[model samples]
Target: MANNLQIASAAYIVMHLLTKKKQSSIKKRRWWTTQIFRSRQLYNGTSMIRDLNFHTDSGQFENFARMSQEDFEHLVSLLTPIIAKQTTHFREPIPVNERLAVTLRFLATGESYTSLQYVFKISKQCISLIVPEVCQSLIEVLKEYVKVIINTFINNSK
Candidate 1:
């Protein structure tokens, strides 16, 4: 009985030591480790802006959005005044061109706000506010254009 008790105590100590040794040898996987963090830091919102290379040989801008480069620029010019940052407390004002481009991309692609947040590097809340505001500005600016299109449709039908 005495010999068995000694063997059991020795076995328990050995198992504990072995378990501690294994734990010390095993490397921990951490998501926020410097190596993983550096890789994730490489993502920038600026890179999310879609290609606007109007001068490129492929004409990707026009083909993708069904609008000429000039028309897009004209639209941006008109909306800039209305959508430009009026006053910001702490945040930097988003550039009018960026705002217009993001709104246009959202409208053209029908992308959701969450996707746009990643693409534009802007917050979803900001995007939610921007899309409607820009659309309203567009409606206000294009009232005349809308009337022309409606009249043209009516006249063509007649």
Candidate 2:
């Protein structure tokens, strides 16, 4: 009878441990999912993009993004149609200018996506996606200028 009780107790302890382990795993998963979908408002509120009045501070803007404000605005205008996203009910889309700024900063600084995420309040995943998409858009939109430059160079050489 004692041996049976010991066996039963061991079985109960094993079952309890398994239940606790499952619960902890579920909790971890919930936390991870919440993190993935968490609001960017907190980060955005303190983000460099929001805090810096770069428009008024052209020098600072140039330092940060490696481009003058005028050129930045021009790029934004040219790229907006290609990069712009529609706002959804869940969240407003990131602005075109912000996307361009992030891409330019990445190009200028060669900062890791993790660091950029902190500065821009955008997820690294989003940054990774934004950088490549913006770069491709820039190539497509700027190919005409490249061609003109190449043609001028060849003509001048001749």
* Shift of residue 106 alpha carbon in model 1, Å: 1.6
Task: Using TM-score, give the best candidate's number.
Answer: 2
Count backbone overlaps in model 1: 0
lDDT of 2 by residue, 18-107 (tens): 999998876433353245336566666225654566658647677777888789889989998898999898687888888988888889
Q: What's the lDDT of the predicted structure labeled candidate 1?
A: 0.73
Best by lDDT: 2
TM-score of each: 0.57, 0.66
lDDT of each: 0.73, 0.80
Tell me the alpha-carbon RMSD of every candidate.
13.1, 8.8
